[model samples]
Structures are given as C-alpha cells and as structure tokens.
Target: MTANEMTGGEALAHMLLAHEAGPIFGMGGFQLLPFYDAARRLGLQHHLINDERCGAFAADAYAKVTGRVGLCDATLGPGATNLVTALVESLNAGIPIVALVGNTHRLHSWKNMTQESRQVEILRPAVKEIIRIDHIERIPELIRRAFVVATTGRPGPVVVDIPEDIAHATYPFDETWFEVDSTYTAAPALRTRPAAENLAAAVELLVEAERPIMLCGGGVHISGAAQMITRFAEAINMPVAHTMSGKGSIACTSALNAGIFGRYDRIANRLIDESDVLLVVGCKLGEIATKRYTLPEPGKKIIHLDIVAEEIGRTVIPSVSLWSDAREGIADLLEVLPQDELKERLAKWAATVATRMQQWRVDVAPRLTSAEVPINMARLLHELNLNLP
Candidate 1:
C-alpha cells in the first residue's frame, strides 16, 4: 500500500472526520473492526456502548441537543436490527442521524454466513434511506450521501451498510474527493424560506385575527428557531402554546406563554379552542398535540409554517400555508408584522392570558405543596424543580 492508497475503513473515517462528525456511539464487532481501528487511529471520538440500540438513542439525543447530524454504528445482523427502534424514533421526531452498519462479506453472504440476515430489508422502514456501498472506490461519496440524506429536508436517520469485503478493499485517496459539502453537516441544512406572497398572506390573517395564538412544535427546537419564535410571539403579544415536544420554544416565564395543549397538558387547549386564528410553527398538530385530532376546533383560521410542505395540511388544513424552515419563516413573519399596531390590538388578549395564567397558577398552587401520604406527582415535581441547579 502506498501513501496515496487508503483502505475503505480509512476512507470512511477520513470523510467523517473531515465533516466534523464525532462522538460516535456503538459496540464494535469483527466485521467493523477495521473501521473501528481506523476511527481510533484517526482520533474520531467513539463512545463504546453495550448495545447498538443504546448507541442509536444516544445519537438521537445528541442531534436533539446540538442540531447536528448524530453518528452511530453497528455490526452485522442482530447489531443492525437493534437500531430499528431508535431509528424509528428519529424518523418520527425528524432528528438527523447517520448510522453505519457492518455486513458479512459479499462473497459469503447467503452462504450460511454467521450473523447474516437480510439487514437492509429490516432497516428500510425505520430510516429515511438505506445505502449499501458495493464498491470500495465509492466509500467517500456514499458516506457523503448518507450525511446529506440524514440532515436535509425534514431530517431523519440514514443507514450506510458496508460489507466486510468493501470495508477492507483499498482505493487511491484524493483529498478533494474526501471534501464534504458543508451544507449537509447539520439539521435543517437548507433553511428554505416561504414565498413572499404566502408570508404576506399569513401576516394579513394574523393582523386581522381578534384572538390569535401561536402553536409551536419540535421543529422550532430542531431548526434552532426557539429564540426567533420567542421574540416574535413577545413582540406581537401573541399568546403562545406548545406541544410536549416544543416545551422550550419560549421561556416558561414569558407573559405570553399559554403552556402545553392537548393530552398531558396545561392551559392552552381552551385558548386554542377560542382563538379566531392560530399560527402554527414547526408542529404537525399530530395526535398528541391535537388531543386525538380534535383541538383548535373547526371554523378557526390557521396559518401553518413548516419545512415540510406536505405536513402543512396533513392534519388541520391551514388557511394560509407558509412552507419554510422554522427560523426563516418566523423571521419573515416578524419582518412583515406591523409590530406597534399588533401590540396595541393584542393588549387586551395579552392581559386576559396573564389573568388566566395567574388563576391557573393559583388553582394548581395547592397541589405543589401537597404533603399527602405518597406525595402527589405535582408536588414532587415542584420540589424537584426548586431543588435542581
């Protein structure tokens, strides 16, 4: 082997490092030993896991927190299968993750090879895409494609299957070939904005609405638009409600906060029912968010904004659909809003929300201090909240 030549495992590690993908999680096995060894030599961070499922979950959490494409790995058959549950979670939650799986040698596959089951078929439904690298020369390109698929447009997990033979094959290295597209390294890679006409239409509805609310979903957090959404809601004095996954889209202490709606929620459901116009951002208004698809009630005008256009009307049809990245859409809405006028018009509503929140706090106050035998969950939660640093 010459300096210009690199093994498939080395190519995979080099490309991942070039893309700054790190803190990988997985339990290594014989089929992936070369890749693991290359990862170690290349100083790529790897957190050893007892199970592949745990690694996938760790990756999911990492993506949720950092807005980056999380990376994980697995060996053949059972190891690959173990990632299904976590992959499905990432798919549904729209978190970006790139999973690398080892495979039996291509020559030995289906010849009664150990740990050889149709892994690709098993993982197809669990991920956005499953890519198998049949040729060693394509390792860098395929790995690059995996990241692109995982992080782009609605973000989800992508699996890159590397047969043992492919992992060990050698190919000439070209630094330029290993260079990664910077765009696909993180979630919401494109940050697309809605059309000017659509944004204008949404603004018109919000301006005209007598009782307007903003409902945020996990997309706010995923797009790193929490701060933008918070600022927009506060500026217009719009009462903001959220689904469970959108908990931190705004500060819990914000005066405009209406809390979570739907099952296992706070005081937002009633507000949603009464609102004349609902501005939903980043949320799909799924079953849990809509209380089995019944909240928001019929006859209410809705302005829906999201990265995925298809989801805009999948549940509750939006009167005005703004298809864009959460942050970009919120920024545009703020840009077009008649701030001074909106604040003045919404003052009464804001006051009402404040009053309602005060009464809610009062209603739940006793539960926070309850010292009953086993102790109420609310009281325990309050205690924990007070004690946590």
Candidate 2:
C-alpha cells in the first residue's frame, strides 16, 4: 500500500504491534474508533476498561509486573483528561507507560474552539515526553521516541497525542520504517573495588572492633546484591539491621537479622549507638533511613559502599567510602579476606546476636501474655519465611 493510502489510526496500530506491545488498555470512544479497528485487525488484545482511570491504572500495574512499557489509549477532550490522575500515579510509582490520547482536528486548534483541548500541554509536565503527531508520516518516529523515553533512566509515562482528523487521514504503510531499535540499551555503571591499601586498612579496623553492626539498605535490592550482603554479613558474624526500604533485602527470619533502625524501633536505635563498626552497603543514609540524619557516635567507624559516587558519603562521612556495586564489592572483599579468621568472627557474632534475640523475646513475652489477643512475633516470622522462597 502507498504511504498516502493507510489511515493514521492504522499506522499507529502497526507501529505499536511492530514494537511487540501485546495489549493496550483503554475505553474506546467515537474519536478512537479507527485506532480500535486497526488494533482488532492486527490481533492485538484490547482490554476494554469501564473508565479511562481504570484503564490507565491497569496499564501501570501491567508495567510493574512485566518490566516493559505499558500502553493506554483514550479519545479527545474529556476522555484524555480523565486519564491525567492515573498518569500522575504511574509517574510517581516509577512505571514505564505510553498514553495515546486522541485530539481534535487541525481546524479546531484555535482557543475556545468547540471540543478543542491542548492535550500535549496538559500532559507535558507529568509525562517524560509528549509527541503530537500532526503529520501521519511521523507516526513511526513518534511511536519509537515515545517508547524510548518511557523506558529509559528512571522510567515513567509518555504521551502521544493523535488528532482525530489525522487518525482518519490516509498514510502509506512502510514496515521498514519501524524496524530500528529505539530502546535504551546502556548498562548501569559497574561498582569499582577499593584499592589494595584501602581494603587492608578496612580489614584492620574490622578485625579489632569489639562490637560491629552491618547496616544494609535499599541499594542492595537495586544493585541485585542482596545475596552478597547476606554472605558477607555471615562471614563476618555481623548483626544485620535494615532500613525501612531494605526490609526484605536480607532473610528476615535469620538469627543475624537485628531488625530495622528508626524512631519506630527503640531497640534498634540503642543497638546502632552501641555498635563499634557500621558496614553500610548499597544504602544511602538518607534522612528517613537515618532517622533525621542522626548517626552513630563519633568514635564509631563507618564503611560505606554504593553504586553512585555522590551517594557514598552523603549522610554520615564514612571512614572508608567504596564507590562500587554492593554485591560485587562484598563478594570481592570476602574472597580476599583470611578465610579461617573470618569464619571464627562470624561464629562469634552469630552467637552474640542469638543471645540478644533470646533476651528480646523474653522481654516481650509478658506483654504478649497480657494482651487480650495473643500475638506471636516468632510464629508470624516463621510463617512468612515458610511462605516466601
């Protein structure tokens, strides 16, 4: 078919299907009929939602589960406006999505024109990118760019405004136009290891510390280094305390799990104050994580490891700052350490942590007994561990 023969809606459907977007979520309207028809013809599943808001939400949920660009579509004017709230939700939640909003014809572009709406302007601030396809020929490029922006960096939503008149207008189909890859492919910066001298110095401090604590954060999850952190903690026999966001990073049921550190947990706060060495991995000591920037005592030693250089010493200046990926850094450190001494230290630390945990259970047992509703913290932890992999 010639470039001028295919309708704008048909071009949109072809572009989306070419990109392998399985199904798009939206409530179809009169302005969106052409696009829906094209979608049906292409065998692309259309999730017919009761409302635009629900459709947008479904797209967001889909993105979160699949880790791919979620797609949503809506008609012009009120239909497009109804999706704003959901778009904002997706933006805040860090979901990758592309919202296809239909617009009025070019003749209705003037202000105060009936059913005229600046859909791009309304969605620009919230979405990562906004593309208004005034020309049908630009559909391929526009769709490609939309997917690129939505899935790159800190992924978020993007909007493609398709005017009704343009949707119905003819354009030639060209399969080759949509063949190029527009996805962001750059890998995350790898974590670098500390120098030999620096590693020796850190080990010296760790070896002499009487009471050491390992503080793990959400960075472990982001860096996919949770296993390394757990292994390193076990190797050094260190008690593992996590930030709110870092809760699931370590197996919560492990004897080494010292619980969360914050205003909400007084025991954890006391433990942090008592510790001599704090090994922070993949976690920035942000205001919330550090309880309003209050840190361990001055005499305490802090070793910080994170992927981003700037995040290394942000909250509390570390005695040793290692700008590296948490997982690899910890594994490398463990590999270089004296295996016998490390195992000995780990056993000692695990024993101490267990003793402390027993004491805590005894202290809280009286409260549990007095409460009208019996609560077993240990049972709850056991159940959760059993259910989770």
Candidate 3:
C-alpha cells in the first residue's frame, strides 16, 4: 500500500482522473456529498448545473467536442431518473458517457428509504453497462471498468451506481488496487486493422469504380479518421457526403465535400444516388440518412467499415465488409491503391455534379432574399453559419 487508506468516494475521483474521463457535469445530493468533497480535493473539476437534465446535456456535449468520455454525476432517486433523457440521446447517438449515481445503502434496499429506486434497471436501457458497487473495496476496479466499457467498441454510455454507505466507507489504499488496464483509451481504434484479403478486395472495387462516393458518419470522428478520410477522398478525388452527426469532421469548404446528407440535402442525396460504387465508413446508414433504405441505387457495390461486426451486416449487407475502425480500415485500402492516382476520369463526373449544384443555387438565390418576415429560413441558417471556425 503506497498511500493511506481513503474513502471509496476519493478512489472514484482518483480513478476518473487517471482515465482522463472528467470535468463532471452534475448536481450534488445528500447521499453523494462525500463524493463531491473527494472530487474537489482531487482537483476533478465539476460544472454544477442547476438541474440534472442540464448536467446530462452539458456532459454529452463535452464528450462530443473533446472526443473523450463525458461524465455526469448525481445522487440517488430523482436525480438518476431525471438523467434518463440525456442517457437515451447518447445511447442512440453512440456517444460515450459515464454516469456516477448514488444509490440507497445495501441494508436499506427493500425498505422505503429516502428517495430509493432501482437505479440499475432505469439506466440499463440507456447504457451499454450498469455496475453496482456493494463493497467500497471494489470501487477501484469498477471505476476503471466503467471508463473502458463506455469508450470501447461501439462507444456508448455506462452507469456506475454506488451505494451511499459504500461511498462514505473507507478502503485500504493499495497501489495495486489502482491498477486499471487503460489500453482501450490510450490506444486509438485504428489498432484493430482489418484483414489483408478484405482490404485488397475493397481496394479493387474502388479502383474499378468510375463514380465512387465516401459516406462518412459520426464514427469517422469517433475513430479520429477525419483527416485521413479527407486525404483519401482528395487522392481519389471522390466526392464525400456525411451525416449531420459527422458535419465537423470535414471542412464544408472542401471542393469534394457534398455537405450534410438525407432528404433535405438534394446535392448529397443525388451524389449517393448517382454513384456507381459507395464506400460507407463509420456510419449506421439509418432510415433518416438513407431515406428509408432507398438510396445507393440498390446492389451497387458497397464497401462498409465499422468497429462493430454486428453493425456491419444488420441493415445493408456490404459487398466487402471491412469490420474495422474507420481510420485503420481506410488507411489499409489507401495503401493498396497506386499513389498520386488522382481521379482523372472522375473529374468530368465531379464537374457534372458541381454544375447541377451551381444551377440549383442560382435558381434558389432569389427565394433566399425575397423580403419575407421570417427572413428566409434557408438564408438565415446559411448566413449564420458562414465564416464559422
């Protein structure tokens, strides 16, 4: 044991710091006061929102912006229940969040204790994992597991429900207890490269493709593959269309960026509709994005890349499934292609799409400026987002 015995609450704080998971967004309650004190003492910053809902939203946004696990903590009962909305949003979006929720004491479980409720069942539907710490000594390992489970693989929220008694209880501070296998966080997802045969086949499809398109989703950002995606797209001069969730991954100013996809964006939808071959990377190709599974021109060669193997085949079966992270999988395919092979044949095809887009913009130009009271909904958004960094 290298340090003095510490409260389980302190151990939670230390472990969160070690995993680089915090700047907790939450509110304190009676049962979790000990945890708040410990967190403050350990220099873990807390952004105390007035409401638990706000805290959840803040934490979710923090995770998206910082590209790390977002953390939210709250005491028992009402606080945990209040966090459900934020939890579901992240669950569907595939964002990573670690929720630290206080629970009633083990002894008080069946009894009508103050603000007692089943925290696990409530959090289960929303999170990938739900852990209950009955023993204070288990805090170190459980806390470590929470971060990894939340951030690894498909990446979703996790809930750690600590009983008040355990949080306030003391545990022997062994340095060994602090041991957490942090490989999931320290290393990028690109480490899980797809097999060589799969890579070669996917590359051949793209190389033979006369009109190819790259469909990026939030996973592109999650895998930190945005820059690589851009470089590869530019190398092949392939037009790219991304889901709204992946907007920031590529600069809108890029010539090949077709902008946000789905029903509302005609240019993006048209490019996908017109493609001879499609490379789907880090995207679910959900109903909203695919417009009820009608796009991609049915049976066109689809090369899909994703972290979850199950996700690869569930909806749209890929001609070549590179069941790997976006960065590594894309990097593999990029490697097989001849270097500096700009899309010479694709230049005219790209120009055709560009010409159509230009004409549409010209047609809509007056409608955007027609002195309407609402100030042209489309123009307002376009002007507002212009020059945005």
Candidate 4:
C-alpha cells in the first residue's frame, strides 16, 4: 500500500490518538488482531484484561476517577456481548464511555460465523448510540461522532461496531477527514450556568431562610464542585447533608457536614424536618436519596439545582429550579450573596444543627468505645473515622 493508504485499523488507531483519547482497555480475540497491531504501531497505551466484563469496568473506573471519556473495546461475538453490563451500569450512573466492538464481515453476517450472535442487537438497549460501519472509510467520522454523542448532554455510553472485514480493509486516507484538534480531549461538553432570575430567586430564599440547609449529591462530584460547595456552605453557615454518592464531595469531619442521611439517618431527618428552606445542589433527590420524598418535609421551600432539567422536580416540586452546573452555579451565587453579616444571623441555627451533630457523636460514643467482645460494627467504623484526618 502507498504512504497514504493504510488499513482501516490503522486509521481508527490514528483517529483515537489524534483526539488524545484516554486509555484503551480490552481483551484479545480473533477479530481484533489488526486493531491491536495498529495500536502498538501508533504507540497507543493499551490495557489488557482476561475478561471483557472486567475490562469494561476498569475503563469505567478510569473515567470516573479522571472525569474523562472511557475508551474500551471488545472482540466480535462473545467478547462484545460481555461488555454490556458495565456499559449499562455506566448509563445508570451517567458516566461516559465509548465502546468499540467487532462484528462479522458483511459477507458472512448471519451466516453462522463462530461465536457470532447479533452484536448490535444485543447491545442496543444498554448504550445511547449504536453506530455500525459497513464501509472502512467511514470509521474516522463515526468515531468522532461517537465521542461527541457519548459526552454531550447527560453523558452515557456509545457503541461503535466495526465489522471484521472493514477492520482489515485498506483505505487511501481521505483528505476530507476532519482533522482532530491538538487540544481535543475525551470529555463531556455540558456547560450549565444558572439564569439570573433563578439565581436571584435562590438568593432571596437563602437570604431570608431562618433555618437554611444544603443538601448535596453525586452531581457535586461529577461537576467538580466539592470546594465550591464547602466555601458556599461555610460562608453562609449552612448545614450540609450528603447522600451516599455525595459523601466525598465534602469532608465528613467539616463542621458544616451534618452527615450522610436519607434512608434512616436520625440527625439528618430531624434537621430536614425542621429546615425552613433547603438549597439542594447537584443532587437528583431520587427516592433513596430523599427517603421516598419525605425528607424535604411538607411544603418546605426548596431551591433545586442540577444540570439536567428533568431531574429538577422529578420527585418533589421545587420553589426554584436552577438548571446549571453545580460548580458554576455555586461560584456565581458566591459572587452575588453577601457573607459579612449573615454568618451572625445564621449563628444560632447553624450552631444548633452543629450541636445536634456533636450530640449524635456523643450519644454514639459509648457504643463506639464499648469493650465488649465481637466488636460493635458501628464502633469499628467509628474507630476507622476517628483516626482519619
């Protein structure tokens, strides 16, 4: 083949590398040899797993930790089928992943190729997009679109099925191919900033809230608003409660952290019941999160903030719904909301909440320190956290 003519596998590997896609993880199989060879030739970093299921999880984990689009692939037939579970999990968690799978060559499709079982049909329900490439030349454009679809809006997995024959087919590089930008990275493109009217509404509620509470969730971590959340709460003397997914968004040891509670948290339930106004940031407030829609209390004024508008009043209607990125929204509110005299106004209520939190620790301290054998499970956990900085 001439210099410009390269195998479809080479074109794919080059496209991914040009876009600076993150780690490529998968298991080896008969149909993927060309792609593997091209990846090696292009000096792309590839991770191997013994099982396609685990390979998908590993890629998903990388995406969760680094906030990048996960790159994973599986061979034709069984290998591709195996990646379905993790992709489905990613979909549920709103994690972004681009899955590459191999399929039977067009010539042998439905002709009973070994291990063949309709790859696209099996994976369609689990992913957001199913892009099948019949012509080898379409690989580059399809891959680009796959990245865009997987990372835009609510973020989920996209699957691209490259037929076995197409993977090995030679192609004269087309000049019409979109050149990947040098700074391009595999990440979502959702930009949410709260509207002025909504922000003002939230501020008005917050300013007059005698017992203001802040409830955070997984979206805080996804939007990278941990520090912003901490600053906002501390500035206003707001007590913060977290869901299981929202725990790491703020340190549990912080005075503002009222503790994780939704399902069966005494401290959090009492505070939620007593709060005059709740400022919910980045949380979906799902059933388990809001204790079957009971925690916000009856007719409590609520300001719900989230990137997806559908989640705003999915369960409990909010007085003000701000569809915006958690980090950006919090940062903007910080700019407009005054912090000087409000800390004094909020001191009594904030301290009551803080005292209740401390009382909870005191009430549980005996169980935590009990010398009884078999070690109380609660005590074991308390010990673990007691020593943590």
Best by lDDT: 1
Which RMSD values do the candidates have, in order?
1.5, 5.2, 2.0, 2.4
Candidate 1, residues 54-88, lDDT tens digits: the string is 99999999998888989999999999999999999
Where is the poorest 10-residue window by lDDT in model 1? 1-10
Q: Each candidate: what lDDT?
A: 0.90, 0.74, 0.81, 0.83
For model 1, what is the error of residue 84's alpha carbon versus the real structure, in angstroms, after optimal superposition?
0.7
TM-score of 3: 0.94
Please state the error at residue 323 of candidate 4 in Å: 1.2
lDDT minimum window of 10 residues, candidate 3? 182-191
Which scores higher on lDDT, 1 or 2? Answer: 1
- TM-scores of all models? 0.97, 0.70, 0.94, 0.92
Per-residue lDDT of candidate 3, residues 1-389 (tens digit): 47668887888887887776557999998677778898888788998889998998898888877767888988888999889999999888777888999988787786999888876788789778898888888788888787778777878888999888888888788877776665644324224789889888988888788888888998888888899998888777788888888775567777777877875575888777778888898998888778887766667789989888888867788899898988888888887787455478677666665676677778887865567886888778667666476
Please tell me which model should have the higher TM-score, number 2 or number 4. Answer: 4
The alpha-carbon root-mean-square deviation between model 2 and the true structure, to one decimal in Å, is 5.2
